[model samples]
Target chain A: MSVDAKERPLTPATEPFAEPLAELDRQRARALQMGGAEKLAKRKAEGTLNARERLDHLLDAGTFKESGLLARSARPEARAKTPADGKVAGFGKIDGRWVGIVSNDFTVMGASSAAINGKKMKHIKDVSTQRGMPLVFLGESTGARMPDRMGAIGRSILGQDRYEYRRMRETPWVTAQLGDCYGSSTWYACMADYVVMRKGATMAVASSRVTSLAISQPVDKEDLGGWKLHTAISGLVDVAVDTDQQALDLAKKFLSYLPSHSNQAPPTYPVPEGSDEPIKDILKLVPESRTQVYDMRRVIKTIADKDSVFELKPGFGRAVVTALARLDGRTVGFIGNNPMFKGGAVDPDGCAKVTGFLVLCDSFNIPIVMLVDVPGFLIGIEGERRGAPGKIINWMNALALCTVPKISVILRKSYGQAYLNMGGGRNSDEVALWPTADLGFMDPRTGVNVVYGIREEDDPALFKQKVEELSRDTSAWDLAVLYEAQEVLDPRDTRQYLIDMIEVHRLRMTNCVGEHLMRTWPTSFG
Target chain B: MAEVKVASEITGSVWKIVANIGDKVVEEDTLIILESMKMEIPILAPEAGTVKEIRVKEGEPISEGDVAVILEK
Candidate 1:
């Protein structure tokens, strides 16, 4: 101000535009510094990237076009302290695709929420939605600003936007928890389609200080909302990584599997080398004997494109495996039962996992491939206590509403009501079966005991006869005879069968888009 | 060294005891096999350790979270 004004001479009549433009430059420079060099260096010393630096790392070089560069606090008293109002929002490209981004600035006032920054967030959301681009939120905040949020005026300011939490699935929303995330950060993370968190980051409704005060007991931050708790118990986070850069990289990778918006098909990559190789290894991975258990994930890897399987909620529901993968370079969702845990029985948690995955695939127009090896829904008082029936029905309801191509492969066991939920019968567009597929109402031994009131040990001869009687017409050929299975495949041909069938069933008339039936499904349930 | 208690992930009866005391086992090694719903589910060691105690016998009923073996890591 001094150099420009003194050199130009302060004369309103002589130079009318000089003063205002100089002031603008000064304010812009102030905003660019972002809580001064000392605070940024402190963050650097702590091995953390500041908000702008994170944006640079996440976005393509020279692609960040900032939206609220001149924005500060709306409150006159706090104007000087709040630059960009604690949030940096802009339009950027992630892997050459346009995406709206909001990165919270923790150095300034803990990146707290206030009136002006809320407007910036709303603007980004509006433009991203209207322009048909995905939204990425790099979340790390200390929650709502205090004193500014106290009193009747604060009550009026809070929750003015009614559609803040409404997720219509118009665009793929991706979020990252890079540090302590609370309030808006946690809310957006919960509503996202894919959420990745740093290993040490914590995400909760409020900071531990307020939580401990409210509960009247000391609380450990990690225990309250850590990576293990969410990934293993809560199922809120899709993946947890070791560093901030890893979280951002995962966010980019997740978006790679989805479209920029629900109206378009996901981008495809070139088919990887060796994709045409036979999956003869699948024969050895799945045991022919129905009673034995094997790792279903190995079967999934053998079927999908090489190194393209990205698993989601891997720790929460041990019985089911949901992942995003590519077949012949096109995106598809895999819902497979894992016999390694709980005998591949769908529990309440597993039901919720499948339901959410179905919603995502349907909303984004990705085809689904279900690898059926489920014994049945786990039955017990514990399952009943967790509302297992409602969750199972919810999964069925979402699957029925889906309009995209669904292909089912009955690898081994597909029994009881779980058969319908796992893409059996009219539930899927195409059904393939291996010769080893075991289709029945229940396990033969258990059914015989329930009907005849005799253990296999007591009447071995009768048990064998009864088991054979019950197992009649339940083989892969039997299903094929009834025209239920489109094809009876050799275990080796499973991968090529899925690829050709997906191409045949691709929604050509609709431009490879689905009906978006489950667009309004709730984002969080586990 | 740490003492890790290996627990059953499901409620089942012990069908077979494959590991004995003083035997060294690696992660995912089958220490005991449990049978439920006509499926033999192996209770695997979560980490590499020496088996210090086998607490459940074959055909004994065990509930979920019931520790079946104590491993010295």
Candidate 2:
């Protein structure tokens, strides 16, 4: 009736507890336990999750196998004062795939990276690289421990092994910005394949407190390292969520789309039964009235596999929406403008959003689906002040650099510079338009004013009559006659069209080279 | 005791500003707007002042947070 020892799951050996070395191990365990408890309480008070809690939420239940549990600082005084040097380094399984994790506990002397902690982190990274395991960093730190890093010892620990930061060709890495992530935390997050952040979390080269003092200004955390600043302005962080749990969930979700390592194929998940719906229903999702706005998000959700969309920067850029979603269980990045905002116009912020999203998708090998209903880039002096011109050019540049399979669906008003920016024509692998699409340089009414030089107020009745005449020339049929779009089809067929086109592009050998852009994009903003 | 004011920058509406005249205004305190694009580009006070004049109203079309009046501090 006794179970064979070799067949059982490994357990801590009792003999090790009885040996003289047991005292040293117990002391190490006690220090770590106490440090963990205090850190957990502080983190809870701050409305943040401790490193271990974050890791637990990130990995599958009961799957973590820790390493370097006994490593301590080499600094004589600091060694006795810190336990595990405030870091928990180990390996764990996320969705049955192995991943390396290192979580920093700020409660232990501010979670500063001392000599031993750095060594532990470097070792974990090295092992993950060699084994081709995905590495995850649950980063929240106060930078390098000043005491340990101020002298000769500091000089020795200053530079990481070049190979440590030199991203391995195959291993995927992810980082979570859980709290105040400065210095090393920021560095690791920048290096990740996917970086997720809590809404109020701060990730910057230096903490706001430090920067404020240095610059002599009252620094607000959001202003200093807010999601808006990073996601919209710098494109440093990938996605920002509202809660700690959501950040953890995003990390898990992002990893699901990527291979455990570059050399292997991405793991496939079971297609949820009955998830597929008729692609024709996508037509009804968009409103018939060109002036009446509908939520692009609803259309996106309907066309994509049920509940597969994971939106990024949902708040910062109200005009354009970027999301990572799955269609038929295959990962793709979706970029579209919400007609509800500025009539789906590409404003400065919207342009920035699309540029960042395109770069991310290109870098990550995620094919793109551009849902176009753009009136055009925002015009007028306000747009110019906000650098609209620069952002538009930037978006176009990013679009041109993209090598992934890009499919453009002109849901409606594909006008002006935005038409080219939204992967129209040569910018896309396949371009299709809904029956109602109006692909043009500008709205017909405005086009008449610019072309005819007739002021609307000068003779309202006459100008109105001319505008109506001009409107007759712009329509989906007009663009089709010129072959601006490959084909104009019924709205309901959009999903199938995209699915078919993506499949065709995916099969091409050229697609592979473009997918590697994610691997080579600079990890941080200079 | 008072002086005429002009718009600092040209753009859109007065999104918001941190200062008003007769409110112990200090130099470099954001006076008002021109909210272009999605950003709130601020127009700071040129000099510290006392209640002088008000030009732009919230939600009103403002090329800049135009100064209607001046400070006598």
Candidate 3:
């Protein structure tokens, strides 16, 4: 490694570091290159993809051009060791659109950030922002390097970069929580526009080790920062997937729905081959029996353009479903209830999930389709303890504020306050119900009990007779008679109905904003 | 004692009242709500209730949980 001493100024130069820095850069790159390969093999053995591999999956083939390839720590002792500071920074294209990327390799000193690595990150961020390219961070790190960032020198490294520090609305940023994402990874994820996490990955403000020592309590990885906790309770992450490949695919799919940068509209892609599926089969997808639970996901996949239902928070909030799917190759947000869990009743987590999704959809001008089959909010002591009522209200508030085209389809039961929350009445622009929909404040059986205090067991004949009488007035026909729902149609017509509704509102208003709540929603906790 | 009248939010028939005369109650506690379509409606206490009288029997049809009356002190 050649050190150009002549270019080294006695005082720190305000200008960019010169070729004297090249020796440090080369050493860092070599260190990372050597450590990265070993680490990659080890990770592959464990059935996980390394950060760089995940980045490759995210970008177009052969399009990556890395920057700061040789950057390393400026500290004399640290500079003599630790190359590339275990981070690979670069720019690449995903489907022809430019994106800046950085993937931390945990094998090199545990992928800890050093002075030069920080500078490299800041530089990449600056370039991406200035050029209006999306920034993607494949984060898998152990926070800052202790040796490099421990004293005054470390504090200097910690000093903020004036150019990239300001989060002016310039470009979109994405972060993938691949593995143990701590410190800088956590920070970047929190600040990103979109964040995707692998199912088994851990993301925390600090690693379990640091947290355990500091707090004097042992913490498990999942307990410290699990996918379920973030997606369900915190609402910090946007999506959690089963595999690294899914995470990468989601990153690509998410970017497809977003513009290359804030100033431009999301690039529209030609509908992929066989993307359109017949709408006729959608009816059979939903079972005829209300008591029988069917996979709502199948219903979503059928309605959306084939292969376009990119689900977010799929494992969390099992009751409420949210996804960004393409309809005729245009991105829209779809929120529905899954009867598979708690009979499609919205619990606190489900409510929070839908609330965030609604905010994102409204902010991004993504039209919404709410498929209703709610049996009201989940009721129980557990529900109360979770502050279910508050979350439900929050959901309602978000729904009320949304100005984009909103459509509602009553798939089955639309009971109680849940009816209003699911875009019933005037909550949506178009409200349609399936023929099987039973709209009422409560089910007939429950209604009979509340009114008469009669157990059928007490007087079976009378109780049966009374239930029959109450059922007469509580059907979909009753709701339609009062104009509560506009139309009740066969389930087969849902696709055509939604397509026509979207077309009607396509030009109704212009949504040109660069950032939506989904993009701005925090990906990490403090 | 104040009168504890259980009114249903929606018009439905009572399924059953788990509470009876002289049953102590708390706020928002479910006395009984009538079931109409397929929902388990809870008729909660307007105030804590001590069953003063049972207005209607289990088999009779009633709107809301107005079948039993309670007194609160």
TM-score per candidate, in order? 0.93, 0.78, 0.74
C-alpha RMSD by candidate, in order: 3.7, 8.4, 12.7
Model 2 TM-score is 0.78
Candidate 2 residue-wise lDDT at A509: 64
Distance from true position, residue A26, model 3, in Å? 6.2
Candidates in order, interface RMSD in Å? 0.9, 10.2, 7.1
| lDDT of every predicted structure (CA atoms) | 0.90, 0.74, 0.73
- The per-residue C-alpha lDDT of model 3 at residue A16 equals 63
Winning candidate number (DockQ): 1
Name the regions of candidate 2 deviating beyond 4 angstroms. Answer: A1-28, A34-36, A42-48, A129-131, A151-153, A160-172, A216-223, A226-243, A262-266, A273-284, A380-390, A460-473, A508-518, A523-526, B1-73
**lDDT measured at residue A253 in model 2 versus the true structure, 0 to 100:** 85
Error of 1 at A350 (Å): 0.6
- Candidate 2 is graded, for docking, as incorrect
Mind giving the per-residue lDDT tens digits that candidate 3 earns over A1-526?
1233345543344546645465554454465463646666888898887756776788888787877656666766665445566788888899888898898877777778777788789888888988989889888889988877888867876766765445554676788888898988988887775789898899998889899999998989898898878775666788788898998887877888876665554565566666546566776677776655556778888888878887877756677798888877777789988765545777777887788677656655678999888878877677788888887887887788776788999988888999999999888888887878887677667777888998878888888887788767656678788887777777777877888888787633344442343344433221
What DockQ was computed for model 2? 0.04
Whose TM-score is higher: candidate 2's or candidate 3's? 2
Q: Alpha carbon lDDT of residue B46, candidate 3?
A: 51
lDDT of 1: 0.90
Candidate 1 lDDT over A1-526, as tens digits, reads 1122234544553577877777776777788788879999998998888999889899998788888888998888888988899999999999999999999999888889988899999989888877899999999999998878989988989999998888899999999998999999999999999999998889999988899999999999999999888987898998899888888888999999999999999999988898666486778788888778888887888899988888888877878999999999999999999988888998999999999999999999999999999999999999999999999999999999999999999999999999999999999999999999989888888888888886889989999999888888789999999999989999999999999999999999999999998899899878
- What TM-score does chain B of candidate 3 reach? 0.71
